[model samples]
Target: MATDTLNANVLVLNKLWQVVDICSVRRAICLLYLRHAQVVVKEGGAFYTFGFEDWKDFSRNSRGDDFISTINYRLKVPKAIILMLYDRLPPRRVKFTRKNIYLRDNNTCQYCGRKLRTDQLNIDHVIPLSRGGKNTWENVVCSCISCNMRKGNKTLKEAGMRLIRKPRKPDWKTFVKNRFNTSEWESWKDFLDVAYWNVELEEDK
Candidate 1:
């Protein structure tokens, strides 16, 4: 029970209250103890912030399975925390990787348009590497094993195949939504709005 409580997921927000990352309960507690973060509690459609000592007091009367017991007291495992100083997210880019490619394409074959399990999918080079195609977002797409085999090392015209859609770099907002859509943590949904986090920076004129 103790181990499970410490390893439970805690949604982390920046000082601006924008969803930033997901961390372990242990990390969240450490941050709280160090005065680097505060636990966020929601009640009656409003959110409240609590410091370590305050949170300890808040947990005293709380009865639930989601808590850790120490020698002196029990601490409720916090569902979310806000970093006291972290106000900016690092510059964002959807990572170029096979898994991201599958996500961008929705795990559906570009040529045959069949959605397949990961085991049945392959990352295909639209213009084969043998033909000097670079491994890039616009060059690679998800393909089923059958379509991959059928289009092996051949140009679309040569293989008598055409793509359903042209692959492009995925939008950052879409990528964030798809990557961090935490359905299990209902509290997180209130903070994961793209409009909140994706505010465009005003440029100096």
Candidate 2:
């Protein structure tokens, strides 16, 4: 059996709010005002208490309205830590992949404002790679297969097409979505916004 005394980080909660991160169960009991209750085991020696029950007991027995209550606790391991990690940096250059091009142009066709699916999309270089344009995020946008096929190896001007919007490097939030794990993003949504993401590009000028 796994040792119950293993030191693990825990999320201390009170009803709907997350109160704190506790390094150990003992610390959570003492420092977070949880009671030392017990649960009966079939072997009759080992026992445990519901963390929530302990908090309720502590709150009821306390002298004043300053009672504390914890709703739940979840063990925090390396996987949990990984899921919570977030970075606030932007990518140096955008890749010439379908996802990056779609994200860079907000899933809209560069020649038209209509939305397109991943399989239905194509990456188009604004300046045409054949004509000194590099395959960078700032120079790529999503295009329909027809637009891509028609514009092959030629500048938009040469293809007699105009862009609905100029392609530019996305800010940090878009960059993060393009590269980071989805689980890591939940904790970061509150800190990142569309404007915060676009601000860095604005400052580049």
Candidate 3:
């Protein structure tokens, strides 16, 4: 139970009360202890903030399962916290990776347009490497084994194949939208944009 509480997700807000990121409960408590962040709590439709000691005092009378027992007291695990200094969202750049490529392509074969599981997809070079094709966002796409073998080392023209959509660099918002986890804390809904609340997360390779 203690381990579960420590590892639970905690929503992080900027000074401006905007959603910034999600952190672990352990990190949140550490920030609170160091005076770098304050717990943000909601009660009676109003939001409130508390420092580490004040939160500990309040927890004395609180009753819930989300508590960590210390030698002298039990600390309530906060669901959200606000950074005392940070007011900016994280950088908006999306890393180019195999998982992201699959995400961008919706796990569908660019050549055959059939959606498949990750194991069934391969990153195919639109233009073969032997022909001087560079590995880049616009040059690679998800392909099923059959389509990959069919288009092997051949240009689209030679293979009589065409992509369903033209590949381009995806914006950060598009990528983040796909990564939002629907199971995030309910307290986070007050800070998160409506568009982000219902999204799902994908595991990175």
**Candidate closest to the true structure, highest lDDT:** 1
Best by TM-score: 1
- Supply the TM-score for candidate 1: 0.68
TM-score (C-alpha, index-matched) for candidate 3? 0.59
Q: What is the alpha-carbon lDDT for the whole of candidate 1?
A: 0.82
TM-score of each: 0.68, 0.45, 0.59
Write one digit per residue (lDDT tens) for candidate 1, span 134-195. Answer: 77788999999999999998999999999999988776555655555454336566665546
Tens digits of lDDT, candidate 3, 1-205: 4787798889888898867788899999999999999999889978999999999998998997779888988789898999999989654445679899888887889888999999999999998999999887888898999999999999999999999998766664555444554545345666654454334432222
Steric overlap count per candidate: 0, 1, 0
lDDT of 2 by residue, 1-205 (tens): 1234434333332232222122444454453333322211111543223343553543354353322233553322111111112233333343446665576666677886678777888777788777899766577778888888888988877889988877766766666555444753553333344353345443122
Higher-lDDT candidate of 1 and 2: 1
What local lDDT does model 1 show for residue 105?
A: 86
How many clashes show up in model 3? 0
TM-score for model 2?
A: 0.45
lDDT of 3 at 90: 51
Minimal lDDT window, size 10, model 3: 196-205
Candidate 2: where are CA atoms >4 Å away?
Answer: 1-97, 174-189, 193-205
Name the better of 2 and 3 by lDDT. 3
C-alpha lDDT of all candidate models, in order: 0.82, 0.50, 0.81
